[model samples]
Target: MQLTTFTDYGLRMLMYLAAQPEQQCSVREVADHYGISRNHLVKVAHRLSQLGFIDSTKGRGGGIRLSGEPASMRLGDIVLKLEPNMHIVECFDKSTNCCAITAICKAKDFFRQANQAFIDVLNKYTLSDTIVSGKSFLEIFALPQPTNPDRHKQS
Candidate 1:
């Protein structure tokens, strides 16, 4: 039930952005912060932007920011969008299923139930829910926490 490295990067990027919703961050900055490959992050950023998860600006002073409120974005939906494949087993994808017991594979139903349960848990949470402490996150990341005056009002 492990997420792909690409999805991991996407999540990381989102977390970093979540911490600084008011500020735009460069893909290089995020990669450097996480000590990951900037090239890979660039691709992730581009995909996230294309998927409408993040907004990107080109040229000087240009960077990226979350497209909408973090609390409104569900984790399950985000994972589904970021992950290219959610099929846990070969039988899940009927188009290329090679399992011999496809007709009466009892285990397939169990796997499907388990997978649904996993997503159900994720669906219960939102991007904002990941940040347990905003101040601590900003302190650790050395990012300035911009004062969102209307933050209290949003709740």
Candidate 2:
């Protein structure tokens, strides 16, 4: 029941943005802070922007910021958008299912219920609810402060 790296990083990006609601951040900055691949963060950022989770701007002084209030961003909704598919087993996807026992598999129903329960739990939380103190996070990562501290409100 592990999430894909794409979803993991997407959540990280959202959390980071939510922690500093008014400041624009670059993918490179986030990648460095999390010790993750910049290339991957770039893809995640692009997809998040396309999905309307974040606003992206280009050229000088341009960066990315959360598009809406973090309190309104449902974790389950974000995961659904970031995940390619929720199918946990071959039987879950009828189009390409080749499982011999697909017709009578009790495991399929169990997995479906498990997956739904997982999402239902996630739906209980929002991006704001997941934020930790930004100061401690930055200090632990040894990342520099946002140039304009006054620009953003800390969660």
- What is the TM-score (0 to 1) of candidate 2? 0.87
User: What lDDT does candidate 1 reach at residue 69?
Assistant: 90
Per-residue accuracy of model 2 over 1-155 as CA lDDT, tens digit each: 88997899999999998888899988899988886779989999999999999999998888899999999999999999998688888888888999998888788888999998998999999998887665554565675544555433546
TM-score to true structure, per model: 0.87, 0.87
* Candidate 1: residue pairs that collide: none
The per-prediction tally of clashing pairs is: 0, 0
* Residue 60 displacement in candidate 2 (angstroms): 1.0
Candidate 1 per-residue C-alpha lDDT over 54-137 given as tens digits, one digit per residue, 9 for 90 to 100 = 999999999999999989988888888898578999999989999999998799999989988887899999889988765676
| Candidate 1 Cα deviation (angstroms), residue 129 | 0.9
RMSD of 1: 10.0
Worst 10 residues of 1 by lDDT: 145-154
